[model samples]
Target: MSGNGERVVFVLDAPGDESLHTGGTIARLLDDGADVTVLFGSATSYDSDASAPTTASAGAADVAAARAALGETDPAQWRVLAGEPQGAQRRAVLGEAFAQAHATAVVAAAVDPALRQAAVDAAGEQGVPVFLSSRVSAVPGVRLTAIDVSDHIDKKLAALAAYPGRWRLDGRVVRLIDGTEALVTGTETYASGSGPAQPAELEAPTVGSRLLAVLMALFAGALFGVLGTVAHQTTIELGSLTIPVGLTLALLASGTLLLGLRLVVHDRLVVLAAAIGLVATVFLLSLRSTGGSVLVPAGVPGTVWSMAPALFAALVIAWPRIPARRPTA
Candidate 1:
């Protein structure tokens, strides 16, 4: 749902996995004008017989041919990541790939467990929606999205044809040569952690949009500062004890605003903008007004109210980003 267009990244274990699982979806996405990027892990051995084992370069060529058969002509779109898909470096590389592509959605079609997990984690951390292929084992509570690839089945078959001995196509039906498996369906299934419940529009934020967000954040912060300043003096007096309810609520609100922005928005600059606005507003309000009246009078409640929000904002802003949880089995 990105304004620039729908850019999809397919994470695959090998060249043939794309044709086996997501061939139809890939063809359909290409026909719809969505930019498709295929990232294959270390090449897979396609030959079941040891005498005719497929080399890495050969497997890569076959996948490139498959993509070509599906009408993906741009060689740049097909990439093979070096090294095993494990460790933080691999995850970081995948994250950078998604970020660079401005991917709207990710398809985790890799059969490798580590690769699958890495893809899911990378996409989730970036807040990009990732769909797992049926090749991936099902985890309960997760939602599924089935794509009707009836119209693109022919293109899928054409792509599969690239894998000579691995897949055999007869007319409209295709069978995997590995023995008792057949693929003649018009539907391709993909599962997501939340399914389609939480839709994400993954366009990279532009300079203009970021500036506007910062300005709005500043306005929001200033607004809260003014509100907190005006309300910090209220108290509930019961017997000899006076409960500073207003001051407590003001500090709570400040913490919530800053923390929520940091976690939900995941944009430090915006949170910093809001913090600046809030603190500045508080400081300005603490000074005497034109009418010689102080909104934040000097006292324990006033001091705490004036200082707590900035401290809360600082702590929230300084908090290190925690990686998102990986999809469960």
Candidate 2:
């Protein structure tokens, strides 16, 4: 038992004598004024003579006998729980019985291979201590230790240090300690490999840089808006129809792209890219405009002129500078 008021003890019993051991252990525990209960694997057979002492040959009658032997004047004090022959049912029964009885320790012989494994697994799951024995002893002082292959102590300590909170893997179960189903599935490898490099010093934008970028974008937008309005008012006629307004929209789009690049890369690359785009826009609008006229209203030529100022400003702000190294004496 841990320092948490839980009990820990060992019971002695033969491999096939779970019934006898269960009854005797319970009787001995009650006599010693210990608040503990005994868990016995269900018997496969039934007999009147065998029922008298709660042996493997005893059926439900043995449970009654065992309860009576425990001096359980109240029906709730001694409860007999029958476990399935194998699988999760058996594990649950043993765990449930141990919890209900408030048994700080358990004493039972290693009987069935399946049961033995189930007991160990369930105890591990519940953080309960189990004691295995091979001989049925009427004595309660028989020393026993649970052989646990799953070294849970170390695993539990490591988990607590890594993630200090209640973690659930299956969405239903809480992984309190090590070897629990939740811990096995949820815990991940920490030292798998290295990660991507941290961004460079230039990439780390200061408050001033961010504010300046925002102001630049706003100023560029306002300048382009004025240019667009001016181009719209002065409709330049080409052949029979007026020039398309899409030219100004294109310039605005190019300026927005440049500002985005500046925000991301934070260097002269943005300015160079934006200047190239702006020059290309102007050339394309010039070629497409009526008679290659720059005065065409609502046309590409007028739009390029309107966007020129903002595009130049973006270039200037996005330009990169070389850092000065300190002089060593």
Number of the top candidate by TM-score?
1
- Tens digits of per-residue lDDT for model 1 on 1-329? 22138899999866777877898888888877789999987566434244233553336667778989877999889877867445778888899999999988999887666677788888888889888886554545444567777888888888888887566777766666555466558878777642234422244678999999899999999998988888899999999999998888888888888998998878999999999999999999899979999988889999998889889888999999875442221
lDDT of each: 0.78, 0.42
| Poorest lDDT segment (10 consecutive residues) of candidate 1 | 193-202
Candidate 1 — which residues are off by over 4 angstroms?
1-4, 45-60, 194-329
Give the Å shift of residue 113 in candidate 1: 1.3
Clashes of 1: 0
Error of 2 at 289 (Å): 99
All candidates: TM-score? 0.53, 0.31
Per residue, candidate 2 scores C-alpha lDDT tens digits across 1-329 of 12234343322222113222233333334444556543445443222223322332333444354345444344454333453344878767777766665655555443354555565556656665555443321223222322221223233333223222222333323353233332222111110101112110113556788567555644554444444443533445888997545555645555565665565555554445445544543444434345655433464565556556455655656566433332111
